[model samples]
Target: MSTSPDRVGVPASDGSDTVIDVAGLHMRYGPYEAVRGIDLHITRGEVFAFLGPNGAGKTTTAEILEGYRRRSGGQVTVLGEDPEHADASWRARIGVVLQETEPERDLTAEECLQLYAGYYPAPRDVHQTLALVGLAEQANVTATRLSGGQRRRLDVALALIGDPELLFLDEPTTGFDPSARRAAWDMVSGLRSLGVTVFLTTHYMDEAEYLADRVAVITQGRIVAEGPPGTLAGREHAPAEIAFTMPADTTVDDLPDPVRAAVAESTSGRVLVHAESTLHILGPLIRWAEGRHVDLPDLEVHRSSLEDVYLALTNPDAHTV
Candidate 1:
């Protein structure tokens, strides 16, 4: 979406229909460049994931979009206002969730939300927000007494009390256990029903795959890849792997010559074929295997997962241990 100078803080007539529009974004700290020439386009109500290893400029870029920090250079318009110059009304249209907020030990879950609700001019019903985050049962429970997962839900409740049009979820499930993480994923998934645009930053690849409509990966201050979770970094075009244990009484040489040619690996009585086209390579092999009356019980079909593609896109050496 292109920005119109006259409509910097409102809907535009420049044929632009995006919630966030960034072009040539850059952030500098002293002599070091953090975010460099990143371009992003996020439409309204879309769930977008920004992923990268540590110190890859994700935080800096998010802060810039949130209006907490000023960028050294770039054109950033979030919710129709340049975040750097955004006012209170613009901020009211967005919500941000950190790992956790300061403990509201003296307040109950409902009270905590009520206090935050007062901050917004047109707040959502406190009860509805509590129920939406699955915290209705804990409404009267003191914030400090809630379980870790429950506290996280309260964080989400606080963020939602304002009925924000855009939400920034920054590592919302950072330290959650497996069950807690899954529960959090479900809650985040429910946001789609609300029609609120979500900007999610997470370390879990599965979380991104399950939640994001599209994902962008950053490395060394640049966007290296961006696409749907299933096809990021050409994952959809990656070669398929056809794997199985070696058939008894059969050697690689004994297989049909066509199938043998597809064999990329054979070791420890196991064989793997990297098939550009699974059916063409697999048909000949399966026919040959069944002809010998053999079962390929351990056979598995595989593709490069999101995590695998992510690893291939970023440099491991650049991440801090």
Candidate 2:
């Protein structure tokens, strides 16, 4: 639980700005193309999230970037070296956390970390790595005795033991409860503050919204949209909706002409107005209610959420509005 700025065994900054760069990337399994000509660039010390539904080629793309799989074509540079031909030193600079791991059941948490630490020429102190991932209190607990969330934290500790410049996390909070998920998010944010570039893959839209500096959404083996979570697929520009429960004895016909013009639909005694300018519609609606000495109940304004935009981008057949 220490937020100390000093991280042991961290490599000196090499002055490289770009952490990951991919151009015209493609991957094919036999005749089926899983990834088709996608391009992305991730900067140093930034959190980048890749989102997609199952079998959307997101996993395939991530594996290629991690050097676990070979690309069919295109150029990839991770940490200023091609992952395909990078040397041991290049591998030392990158860390990968798989979706699931089965650590030795009998080994204590600290023991597991110490085991992995020996793999690197310069490894972080086992105790410090435990604290960095919020696992210091559980250091002496056996791996099998720990909870699911605790085990996930151990996975991260193992990944960080090498003091990697770049870390790849695949669904780091898969089975976590709400509180645990928030803790994991805080850990990731701490990693970013320490100048580690994170390449994240997760199906959770809210996680991407909260953690990623930029996001790329993949569907049907291609990138459909790429931008900040707030603006991806123009979610920021999508129409705003003003909704309110109709006061008793106030029929749709009783609504003012300007208010009625903005009405998109109504259901269960509630009226929804869709407009680009929410205030323009809300102002008149409020004045109309005031003149009638009636209050508009349960008034609410809403914009497209990140989940809304993500679903629309991943599923073209789905309606956005």
Candidate 3:
């Protein structure tokens, strides 16, 4: 799909609320393919996270959407225009926060924002942008003097100065301390409240879980799973693990038949049970324990985490690609 520069503010023709659309996208370098026919979409005013390990097609796919690298084959539309041929007006409607930046050492934060604001037809107030990014107190500080977290915030301020409708954030909080990362997350959440669509790429699992409305996992140039972080790869329905300390005199063979069926691992005093329904296994085990007047010590139940699902989906044995 193609949109003219004059149609900069127009909605998509398909009547869908999508801000980004990619179908059968692929990228190639010489004979090696970096992206292999991946299809995905991002809706308006939602935070969408793209996740993958190193050497996956995450970077290639993001670069294509950002208009940095042309795809080898696919159909892509960003804000109703083909990114490869989008014009300056189309560019103005989008903002990008790269993984790192190097601003002029001598420029103050306020001065830096002012300079970038001049490039857009309508820019946000410099002071307001600084405050939004928690850099209001550091407005006069030189770029070189700012701390790592402050510099990262400045990058976000620069991206927002143009009042963009769509924001692309590539690892926005890579080196942040825990507190700083949470602060950055708040800023991204604020952007969503202002009706800005965010396309995020990050390696942090918790970050994706906290900030994304939906997540897509890509591996070897193809998407292996896509859904809400909680349910990705059917994680919500995956088995729950029940672990407890067995009594000193207890043996695996002595346990009830139902309990034995659920047992997955056992050590000297510890037993691990994998069950689809905790109540099914716990009921029988509890009855046996109560009848004997013994305690089920240190019992704990845990469902699969996003990280667990991710590792499973991206397992090296899944496919050669």
Candidate 4:
């Protein structure tokens, strides 16, 4: 869909409604360019994740898009307005959950949300916001008394006080335990269910896999790959890995043909199979083992995960090891 008349719409390359349109974005710190000509289009109501190693300029690009930093060059339109020039109304429409914050130590959770809600013209109910963020039980608790995860939830609740149309979550689950991280994931999923667009910067691949509709990999100030979490770097369709413990009697040299084409290795009590399709070789491997009265132990099948693809695409040199 097209944006405001003067601001031309980015033609949807992947058939998605554009919420953030950026082209040739650049940011520099003195003589050193942190971001060099990056282009990305975040679709409406979709979770877009930005992944990169340290010093890859992911943060710089995200800051420019969030209006926290000025871009040295290139076109940036967030929700159809230049983020750098957008006013309070524009700011009100966006929610941001930063990495860290030290709010007033004395304020209660309810009071905190209530205070921030006053700034927005149409804010969500404080009590409801508190419950939505799983902080209802801590409503009356002092900010300093809350745990790190609870404090992070409070940050999210404050960001949602404005009932924003777009949300920016940067390393939201940084210190969260597994359950807390799952809770945060559910909250993000809930926001998307309400049609809130999300721009996320995270190091957690599993979190990205669970929440992101699409992921972008940035390295040395450039987007090397961008697509659905599963499909990035063509890994969505990459082969699966099958591994099982073979009986002590079966040796590598005794394995059958055609099936042998998919076997990556076989030694002692273990066997590893790499195949384009799991169905093609799984049954054969089982039957072959059974026919020989081989007792297979701990059979497992694994596909190329987002983490694997991320490492492969971002640091090709490291994969050599």
- Pick the winner on TM-score between candidates 2 and 4: 2
lDDT for residue 213 in candidate 2, whole number 0-100: 94
Q: Total clashing residue pairs per candidate?
A: 0, 0, 0, 0
Q: lDDT of each model, Cα atoms only? A: 0.85, 0.88, 0.86, 0.83
Q: How far in Å is the alpha carbon of 45 misplaced in model 1?
A: 1.4
lDDT of 4 by residue, 142-181 (tens): 9878988888889989989888878888888987889999
Query: How well does candidate 1 score on lDDT at residue 75?
Result: 95
TM per candidate comes to 0.91, 0.92, 0.88, 0.90
Clashes of 4: 0
Misplaced by over 4 Å in model 4 are 1-16, 290-295
Q: RMSD for each model, in Å, please? A: 5.5, 3.7, 4.7, 5.8
Error of 3 at 294 (Å): 5.3
Candidate 1, 8-111: lDDT as tens digits:
24222244469899999999999999998999999988999999887888878888999999999989999888998988767777988875576587999999
Mark the regions of model 2 whose C-alpha exceeds 4 Å error after superposition.
1-13
What value does the lDDT take at residue 80 in candidate 4? Answer: 78
Better of 1 and 3 by lDDT: 3
The regions of model 3 sitting more than 4 angstroms off are: 1-16, 247-256, 285-297, 318-321
Error of 1 at 237 (Å): 0.9
Q: Model 2, residue 27: displacement in angstroms?
A: 0.8
